[model samples]
Target: MTGQKPVTIVAIGTLDTKLVEYLYLRSQILEADPSINVILIDAGRAAIQHEAITVSQPEVLKASSASDGSLESLPRGEVVATMIDGAKRVIGDLVNEGKVHGVIALGGSGGTSIAAATMRELPLTLPKLIVSTVASGDTSSYVAESDITMMYSVVDIAGLNDVLRAVITNAAVAIAGMARGYAVRCATPTGSEVRKKCVAVTMFGVTTPAVTVARQRLEEMGFEVYVFHATGAGGRSMERLLREGRLDGVLDLTTTELADELVGGVMSANEERLTIAAKTGVPQIVSVGALDMVNFGPKDTVPEKFRDRKFFEHNPSVTLMRTTSNECRELGKRIASRLRANCVDASAIEVWLPLKGISAIAVQGQAFYDNEADGALFDAIKAGLDGSGIAVKEVDADINDPKWAESIARRLVELVNSKSKG
Candidate 1:
């Protein structure tokens, strides 16, 4: 039941058992927004004894299967993996074919898993709603870095009832309202202006001075700069954006995440952090922005093994630990090796070293002063890059100095333009 077919409201669930529930939802959504188009997607293999749109599961499977028809031929465990992959492909094809605008799915644990998997594959702008028993517990896993709204079914969806129907209707109508009233037009319009190149910068409070200086310098050079705090989430999101091809170049100054990664700290980035620059092969300028600190929770919560380490009270709740010489050596080698992986892009990268201190406190007269430790870090950077031809410079100024920041930005602009032209 549709009027203008402005949006395709997707009703997805286990059509074998929850067909009635999903069909009711489709009817309710259409009733709420007459202009909306309701498209039923049955991901389940078995059919239910009810009204439904019967696109064969085999057709959906074909859309996601590999060459030689091997994707559908996997074992049950592998099938579950492939089904999630298959659902994502089916939903994506539906979206591309202009058949679905908003998606609504209801399921128990297994169904919830598939629904969430599909919803996640859909972009952030698309409205997604899931009604599941899984929503009652920790939803972090189900909604990992996604925007799908989930509602817990108070009763199991054994069959549609007065209560269950009411819940489904609410979700359907809410989705309809979200879809019809405030339709999310994709940000990337058909004729919108082209995206400008954006610069990615990494910083912590310790490296704010440098980042601020660098941002201003890069902005003057006609580049958009996005600074990410050197925290776990910050690093992850930046890498995610880089992989999405959203970043033009990187000014990764505060490389403290690598220290935490190797030393076992709270703010440690995953192994993928340092390797991103090499993987993307994009023009990037990197330095030991905040290699001095290993982050932890509140001061009192620091682990027992590193109780004697130099601690800095960055703020009331946050604590920072200076990396040891050995830790610094390992971290430097790890970073150099990662950067060295992209030999083709090596000329596009430069590992600048600040001679004074890596961070504010590590300088000659600061509380965390340790010239030997700083030297160890510098030595690691030198030894790690056994000549991939990646430029490694040793600047005499402190990292926070304005000169240090400007130089990094200038070098990045040079590499970006070089790569852009070639």
Candidate 2:
């Protein structure tokens, strides 16, 4: 271990409720590896016995100036939000400054929320672990796009029981091993040096043909193409990369996530789906690929009102619902409006429409074919851009047509090249 670097792990929690548990976790981490150093940060909202605190409450509170006076004086929601901001700043600074090697946290829902917020601020490859009572259930909100490992805490974190001791000890050992073995840092700093230009593309099962061709063309043009799966989480990942300056341009071919968001569906993305591309001014080519249907879980999960509407069983676990003309109109207006507002710094923005069809299932004889809905979408987008400077183009071929995909690929390459020259 002579050449090995020192390993430091950050233990985060609301120390007021779980002080004894955290202390045990810290001890176990040191016991696991003699070389591991531990820092106990107090993220508790309520006033606690400060004698046992490592990173004092006042220091943590200073990270976020947005918070009001006393932590207890504000409402519960405000407290959680403020602490999240503060924790993110503290943890992010530690990683950037190269003071912390890994992060581990133990909490229930509220505590997990605080720790998760901070962990997300770190990069994708960092070793971040969370032992939570809510880990066994839906953890989408907790571990959005980060590489945080969630270990189910069979017993509550209120106190130390025989069951909790083993769980906490195992989590401590896991983080210790990870910290000792692997060191994570930002491999490619944005704009640090010249490298391959990255293009972000969106794809779905039905629109795979378009994205496949586009990806090949972009790669052949000496660019790196990253295809995102158009699921709610996938869109969020793309947005994060855009914010981080990891992408050079965007080929937004599949806007199906918007339909899911507008309707109540399992794959729905948040309202901020397209805002990042707009605000970042990344040269983006938009399309209505796969916008013909909204995604839902099983057939039984489809809502009561939508039961009468057209439904296609994509698979045993997935159901697809066709969008009505009225719904398509709303989606078109929303996409155009967002682009109009956020594309100020963009060098160019174009909306491509596939007149023949938007997806495999939306063709002439396909189950999801609905010309009225598709037309409404197309017209609404054009109407929304009436005064806006963004250009709209229509192609005679279907969305999956080889020619259609090639055109989109060429358009993105042209925009990227033009931006570089300018």
In TM-score terms, which candidate is top?
2
lDDT (CA) for every model shown? 0.79, 0.87
- Model 2 per-residue lDDT at 415: 89
Question: Candidate 2 lDDT, tens digit per residue, 1-422?
Answer: 45555788998888878899998998899899877778788888865665546686666777877676468678888888888887888878888887787899999999999999899889876789999999999999899967789999998898898999999999999998888666533322366766899999999999998899999999999999999999888888888999898898999999899999998778877888888877877889999989999999889988898889999999999999999999999999999888888877634788999999999999999999999999999999999887787889999989999989998899989988887787
Ten-residue stretch with the least lDDT total in model 1: 181-190
Tens digit of lDDT per residue, candidate 1, span 94-171?
788766668888998878887898897776557899999878997866875467899998888778889998998899
Residue pairs with backbone atoms closer than 3 Å in model 1 (clashes)? 253-289, 254-289
- Which ranges in model 1 have alpha carbons more than 4 Å from their true place? 1-5, 9-32, 43-82, 96-112, 120-194, 298-304, 313-318, 360-369
Candidate 1 displacement at residue 261 in angstroms: 2.4
User: 341, model 2: CA deviation in Å?
Assistant: 1.9
lDDT of 1 at 315: 85
